[model samples]
Target: MVSLSDYLILSSIIFCIGLAGIFINRTNIITLLMCVELILVAVNTNFIAFSHFLGNEAGQIFVFFILTVAAAEVAIGLAILTLLFRVRGSIDVDVTNSLKG
Candidate 1:
């Protein structure tokens, strides 16, 4: 039987992987966005696991909202990425830093 601690450990592992991906691969905006999504997935997993174990619907509801927000974020992020690619011809993070002016 799986316990809450097991779920927590799984979530933490996923979170760490996502965090590491972001830090280790700073060259591509797409990779960064993917890592952020992975982190969100980890959070959602925790919410679902806790909600199931505690017999409460609140965590599930929060996951629903988090998913909704995540979707919107993806849409906007992709749009920005598209524009950046169109203008700069490259999606490298360092290339974006030159747009400050």
Candidate 2:
């Protein structure tokens, strides 16, 4: 039988992997976005696990809202990335500095 600690540990591991990915790969915007999504997923996993173990729906509800926000964020991020690529011809994060006025 899996315990709450087990779930927490799993969530932490996932979160760490996502964090590491973000730090190690700073060249591509797509990889950064994916790492961010992975972090969100890790958070969602923790919410679901705690909600189930505690017999409360609040965590689950929070996860739902988090997912909704994540979806919107991804949409907006992709749109901006598309425009950046169209203008700069590259999706490199370092190139984004030129956008600063």
Candidate 3:
């Protein structure tokens, strides 16, 4: 049977992978955004695991709120990235440092 430690270990592994993706894909905005989503998923996994173990609904409720916020964040980030791409012709992180419009 799966235990809390197992769940936590999986969550940590996922979180680490997300962190590594974000750091390794330094020049790709889309990949970085995806990595952020991965990290959020890892967090939600922890919340769900703890909620189940503790017999409380609070963690699930918090996870719901987190999902809502994450959805909004992705939408906004995509929109901004689209606009930036249109203006700059590429979504290079280095180019954004001197963004002028």
Per-residue lDDT, model 3, residue 78, is: 98
Least well predicted 10-residue stretch by lDDT in candidate 1: 92-101
Model 2 ranges with Cα > 4 A deviation: 99-101
Instruction: Judge candidate 1 at residue 100 and give its lDDT.
Output: 62
Which residue runs does candidate 3 get wrong by more than 4 Å? 99-101
TM-scores for every candidate against the unseen true structure: 0.93, 0.91, 0.92
Kindly report which residue pairs in candidate 2 clash with one another.
Answer: none
Query: Per lDDT, what order, best first?
Result: 1, 3, 2
Global lDDT of each model?
A: 0.95, 0.93, 0.94
Tens digit of lDDT per residue, candidate 1, span 1-101? 99999999999999999999999996899999999998999999999999999999999999999999999999999999999899999999889675465
Task: Quote model 1's TM-score.
Answer: 0.93
Rank candidates by TM-score, best first: 1, 3, 2
**Model 1 residue 94 CA deviation in Å:** 2.5
Residue-by-residue lDDT tens digits, candidate 3, 25-70:
8688998999999999999999999999999999999999999999
Scored by TM-score, the top model is: 1
lDDT of 3: 0.94
Cα deviation at 97, candidate 1, in Å, is 2.4
